[model samples]
Target: MLPTTRSLRLGFYTLAIILGAVLAAGLAMRHAERQALVEDAARANQQLALYANSLHTLIDRYRALPAVLALDPQLRAALNGTVSTEQQDALNRKLEKINGAARSSTLELLDRTGLAVAASNWRLPSSYVGHNYGFRPYFSQTRTQGTGRFYAVGVTSGIPGYFLSSAVTSDSGEFLGAMVVKLEFPELEREWQGSDTLLVSDARGVIFIANQPGWRYRLLQPLSDSDHADLKATRQYDKQPLTPLEYQSLRRFDDNSELARVVGPDGTADYLWESLPLTAEGWTLHLLRQPQVAFEDTRNAALAAAGLWLALVFLLLFLNQRWRLAKMRQRSREELEQLVQERTRDLRTAQDGLVQSAKLAALGQMSAALAHEINQPLTAQRMQLATLRLLLDHGRVDDAYKALKPVDDMLTRMAALTGHLKTFARKSPSGLRERLDLAAVVDQSLQLLDARLRDEQVSTVLHLTRPAWVRGDAIRLEQVLINLLRNALDAMQDKPCKRLQIRLEADEQLWRLTVTDNGGGIAAEHLPNVFDPFFTTKPVGDGLGLGLAVSFAIVHESGGRLSADNHASGAVFTVTLPIDLEAPVSC
Candidate 1:
């Protein structure tokens, strides 16, 4: 059926709105996906750097070992002449002791012709004493270039190791033999076992070292005829079979990273691949992390964008309807009066919505600030858990039980904090009013941070009157003291001398408490805004600057005054509250 012009126009508008909302949702989802990938790349790059450092440090530790042994006079004299069987035994003992002292995998001395004369593993059936390594690349390279390095499987021991070799020359500059130190990475590989896959591949894309068993000796690319022949001649990987790893790049983030789909031993899966080139070793460290963008995050972004699109469309429709109604105002006085009444109701509804939205926004901000305050305790809890795990692993049940005590305390503190924060957010009276001991509050606050004080070696002095009375919430007061103490500790970082002093005394009807730190006092300009929300002198990502602001609010609600000042040594923060005459001297 043929539609009227008005009906057709309305149908077309509805179609456009639907399409626009879908378009907005798609765009938002794509943006979220890209953001997630970018974050993955950043984290993968950091992990890549750490893996590279570990590899480089392990290699460098043994780089000079072979060279040092080459300079040994006793080792050189033994290799110069045809030694008796007794002298050969002595050389083996000497090499074994040196290997034990250096904690190296094995040490072997070769003659000018590359025949093993003395070896640390002389007692083993697979001893390298009679092996001729003259065919090996390291031997040839050392004979010609004075030093050499190679990673290869030991033909005798059937174990893979990195070999560092240095030429042993006579006093007259004649090359005699090579001194070699072998390094194995069983410990390093064990250390890397976790969620992510770590791989170290050579220049030819042949992976030799991997944290996962199935990934070792995997081929990233097809080896050329020359490379294949070289591998066979050098016996670099010995009997280890090289399996090809099929991977396709789904997206490229940069030269060093990409999103890749891999058909590995674990079957098909997508991963964010990050590579770090080790120029010194001519190897590349690869970290494969699975894409971890939560579905909820993408869904939320799409929903928000679509909602915005619908809102804009409705707003235009509303304006159009208003304009049409305005034209009718000239025609009917009665209709205009009805329109005025309807507009008033609409305005009232909008005003109420605006107020509710403002409240929600304020609540969200306050919640974020509370989260900032609790972050330290949460972080400490995580660290304590890690320590507990280690202690338990070492059979230190007593130490592990002791460690659990602080975790329990932190949990109790967090539970109380969450309840108080909800109350603090609702615009309730500053804080609870009750008779409490200020000294007790201070002691509890310091107890929470006792580990930090001992670890940072900060000297703390307490000068307080016992059972100093105060009228405030004990937990809230503890929060304020903790914030000040943390700020002081942060300021004192890297300083030559770190000292903190806390003083509590009676002043008229008010109890006065001051916190002093030799942390190079706060800047004059920043002191004015210390209690202001979101004002931070710290570098971005280091702090949220909500601690002091939240602390100030908590204090103010408790009918207390909190102020900051600068002193010769550092910063001084004072809290003044009305004394509660009811708090007991003990218990």
Candidate 2:
């Protein structure tokens, strides 16, 4: 018996459904996790905003100190160049006292003539003291805005620091000079240190300082080596465990806070980090929380849940397969019992019905072929009858004899056609292989569609190069071609520019055949699924959707491949068959 297409299709769809269900379940779980993560991120962003405001205020206070020093009367008189050496020393000593309290890196005062008149900790050369400080942005801002604050490197200190300066004026309210102070970061690192949090203050683009211990801050970026070394040394003072061997994850967010997650070597405790931004540069104030206290139970639960889900899936599959097999066996027994009780006539009737169903499926094309096939014989019979009648009317016996020969030939041709139809309609026993010319099979297929093609004003271009042979059933190949041509015709039914082209070519290895139509092209998304059974773009009731799929199966069974692609103008389907050179061409 030929394999039932319906059963095979049912099995395939069942497998697909099972796989799709498993994939959908996994995707749903992943989506839930993603939604939870998004919620956490929103909360983190809210906390970051509060931190930014606090840091901006602290920087403002540092700028206020420089403005107070520039307004001192003692400093103004000395800057005016009217003071004694003892008076100048006293002014310098007073300025040094102010700088020491701030723990600043450098301090200086400059007069209206751009002359530095006072210094702290570091001294300037006598000739260089009166040179221009007006050219620097810090001093220029102090002159323009009367008070300015920014981070800049020292001209003399040669170290990166914050420069806070402001304009100075006399009691008459006339501008006299400016006072500037530089606060070096190494000093700040000592005072602003935290226990658990690694802190870094990046001024403008440079990281002037960092406070952390050892290799804990080794892999971080946007910080210099000196800053990292300082941070590592500070962390060591706290007696915290900081090791490079740990698999640590440090995340630096846009808010400048760093989250450090460290997985220790022994796996005894993982780290969970929370950071609060600094009140000074919006930099981080981190707190590393030991995760063993919080997430150990959650991790164990997750592992257990994952294990249970996998076990459940396998159990379900096993139970489902067992149930399906039992059901299949039950159905098979019922079918076998029915088969035993079925009469011979019933079986024969069923066989005939199946054959008739196949014929009706191709009825439209078959009707066109039958009309063309019978028309020639009927025409010959009519002409002979007319001649016989005329010969009898004229009483010409010899003429009637010649007409009898033609009449016999027409009847014989009609008999041969009926015989061919019987063979075409019969199903060959399974596993029977025959060597046949694929080109002749194609010709027979075209003959079935010839009348319809002509009626639709569709023309076919045939390029039968040579005898391309294949080891396959001719009837099966013919059926595939008939389906293809009919589909082509239906596709072009509404096209104003309808054309069909079939080209056959062969080499030593393969037989290549292409059927092309100048109709509306298949949509791009539909191309891949065009061969799938029951997938049709056609309107309802227009197609059963099994033709191309059946055609695909037929080609595959013959050790061939069939593919459809969208052409620029329409759709083209090509078939490649492995050819047998020794096979004889069959009519």
Candidate 3:
């Protein structure tokens, strides 16, 4: 036979639910990927800012060296007076000593005619002592403007460095020569070797410094005719080609970030390009980072979360379906049983008679305990009434009145015991909820059991620290406490050292009452069945085994829990009741 229409509909609904979950999960993954990209871009921008600051600090450190050297008396004197062989040698020694201490690439004293008179590298094979720098812009610019800066490849050493120049002047304010300091940043470039690509470009869109050597001296944009002419005239790059880097802006995220396809020396790939402007020096720093790893992690995390959510949804659906099927089977079984009962009405009547007989037998078993409980008060009342009658016969009215008081108290005690038995046998009340003091309820329960506790020689301890207000029926709560106390007392009846402890604690959310007894603890095998209906460890006729079950139901209905555990010395029962936060505080 084919599946039913209901099964087909259920299958379709399950498929739809799965498809919808997959779609939502895919959207979430995409959103996570985009957010990761944005965060990566922000981190790249911060790195660019740090690199820019480091470069600026590196350059400023050499800026003051040239001006300070311009004020040296030996260099000024060598330029102003007639230069003999001895004087030139002395000037070279002075410049070499100063350059060595400053850790600069080179320091030179240039005459007004732009010819190097003394150089820091005079000891090297390729010395600049007699090299003419008349073609260099730093020489002429400093002569006219008092100071100048330039970045270019060295004509003598063929090394790239920045040149800082300051004009030397005589006491009469006559321009004599210029002091030039060459600052090379090989260490700075070495420090930038890492995963990220770092580059700095001048205002003219020409890259001067880069971690990758192939990227250095590349032009970000095509140069104008005039700019090319100026570079040729100054010989700044010294015959090096100013190649244009192949890059296309694929997408722009914001003003500070973009995605670009860059053709590097190795190959072409996409990169996240982040830029920060160096406002102090009119330069810009760029950082290129790969986004593949970050995007992959985001995708994985989203899929994991989606998978977990889907699993929970499927589990819940399966449980609900199983419960529905079970209910259907139960209903069918009940109908069958009802039909059978109707056919065997006379047989059922006989069975009912047998059930009543069994109930009567159970009542007979309980009769002994009940009789014991009621006998003490009844016997006391009888004796007191007899004494009262005797005192009245002797015409002692005052003594008779005292005797009558004792008889009345005993009768009242008996009435209370019977009332408790009636309440325990009846159905639990439905709508008698009120805000009641939990401490007072506990005290009342303890008072009802006080005589039994004293008779059994059980030491009682109370740790009620403060008022615990809870919402529930007072009678029901008291009944629960009374049952627990009676059970604890009964459990310790034969123990050598009998002790019962009750504690009340409350927090903002709930009130907790703990009842502990020293009864050598409950047996591990019987613990799980302790709260089950009609299941107990006591002898058959000793208990009906419904006390804890009834207490558990009452506590659960009142939005609380009743739990039992074995302590080292005995058994512990805890009752947790929800505190009525909105109720007025009471003492």
Candidate 4:
């Protein structure tokens, strides 16, 4: 039944008072939180920025000493021309004196290619003496990107330290060499740890440096169930970098009280962020605090005073109409039930969509691998048929027979390829586990691409750790090996030195195989993105870019992983496979 106007008015007032108190308290807490957060972020950032400036100034001072030596008349004269034994001895003595006076660690004189012509304090290996330093980012960008700098690990001070390098050039704009100065990051770590705050910098938002020394700092939280889900949501939003104030708010905001002022994206909100720029490190620091913490006492007092007023008002309302209040409570309970059902349905639909998307992605990767696998046999068949037709047209009966032999071989390969596809498509039960010979599986996979390897003039050296056993799908393990070899061949195709090495190592419960090539190595920047799906370096139409993605899936399915990195000469892809724990193993 519909309520009367008087009852409706009373219910509206009750709801208004409850909601108004909650909103007022929340606003009061959040306001104070924002102010405190701003102060804390500013103070912490100011100190870090000051230290960074101090470090930069010190580096600049030490770097200027080399320019002083370069301007000295005696130093320039000794470097310009050849001299007799006595003159050379005197020049050497002068250089020694300058080096001793400068007191700079690891002084070196380099030519145009960054090769060290002479050095002080430590003798550098001749192998690297004339090598090109142009590949290093600091040297490469020095002329154009003036005052370029970067961090690199070095072993000059009887211990490893970060080397800061700067370019050295003559007055006429001729590039001479680069000067490297070492700074002890460990010492800096100690200073930071001793301070009340921490400093972190994300290198142009790509590489994140956490100030702690010795411990490998992780910018991302552990993807564990125990971590607060709200925090992860904030982290995902942060990956694309937020405004300076937004970043500070996310870090400094107290999570316990659900009170925060989030700056709206696109600068949409007026009372949103508190922008605090840390000028020293050129970082825009954002600050957010817990609003509840700020106004808790005041809010509590206000509520207590309001409670006395509410008591008198409630007494009058209840005395006038008790039955109407019970009816309103019953209606609220019914509305809550309806809302729960609707939200539950929505959540279920979202989860189903996520599962479907994951399946589609997996299928897309498999399709690409199938394309690569099928193309090999098809190409070989075409070449073989072409050769046989030429022999037949030439009336060379013996040669025709010889040519037809390869054609026959191609058809057999096609049959085998079809067989592999059939096996992969089968709906076999995977829960049943059994011990399988991993090396045998790898050898069988290599046979699939033996013809292609021979055609491309590529050589293989297989060092098998025999009797290796793993608990996994036999077919899937072989597929992983096949994908790796195919990728290795693709990587080495342009190299003058065409060689691939496949080495295997096995323990009682694990198997590791390394597929290496002697081709040009991978560029450092592109190394991390290689495994991402649809990421290919090949020209358009050459690849759909799912080779490694499919390989990774197979390894993971078998309780293993595949990793790739650049070696000294070329790239190396290593696969680690889980094996039977009780298997008898030998190398």
Give the candidate number with the greatest TM-score: 1
lDDT of 3 at 311: 53
- Model 2, 1-587: lDDT tens per residue? 24678788878967775665555545544543343333333333333333333333334334445654664567777766665678767867876766665545557788776567667763544322444656565666777778655554444444555667878877777777788876655644454343322333332122234444342322333546775575444221233322233335554433533344564333433333445534333344333333221132233333334434444444455555556555655655566677866555555655565555455445534444554565456545545654464345335688678768676665465345434532453344323468887888887787667788778888677888667778887877777888888888888999976889998898569888889998887888998888774578888657646678778877888889999987888888898988786744489
Task: Rate residue 316 of model 4 by lDDT.
Answer: 47
lDDT digits (tens) for residues 1-587 of candidate 3: 35688799879988887886687678767776776667667656655655665676577556656766776677788888778899989888988877776677899989988889989999998789888997898898899988877888888898988888999999998989899999998899998887678888877788888897688888888899998888889888887878888899987899879989998876898899998776545678888877643444455545554555555555555555456555655655666677765545545544565565555545544544444455455545545644554345335788677656576665465346534422332223344577888998887788778789888888999999567888887767887898889889888988988999999997567798999999888889988878775567888556656668777877888899999999999999999999877757588
Candidate 1 residue runs with Cα over 4 Å from true position: 1-19, 329-587
TM-score of 1: 0.57
Clashes found in each candidate (C-alpha, N, C closer than 3 A):
1, 5, 0, 6
**Best-matching candidate per lDDT:** 1
Model 3 is weakest, by summed lDDT over 10 consecutive residues, at 421-430
Local error of candidate 1 at residue 47 (angstroms): 0.5
State the C-alpha lDDT per candidate. 0.80, 0.59, 0.76, 0.52
Ranking by TM-score: 1, 3, 2, 4
lDDT of 1: 0.80
Candidate 2 deviant stretches above 4 angstroms: 1-61, 81-83, 101-106, 122-132, 171-173, 190-206, 212-587
Error of 3 at 275 (Å): 2.2
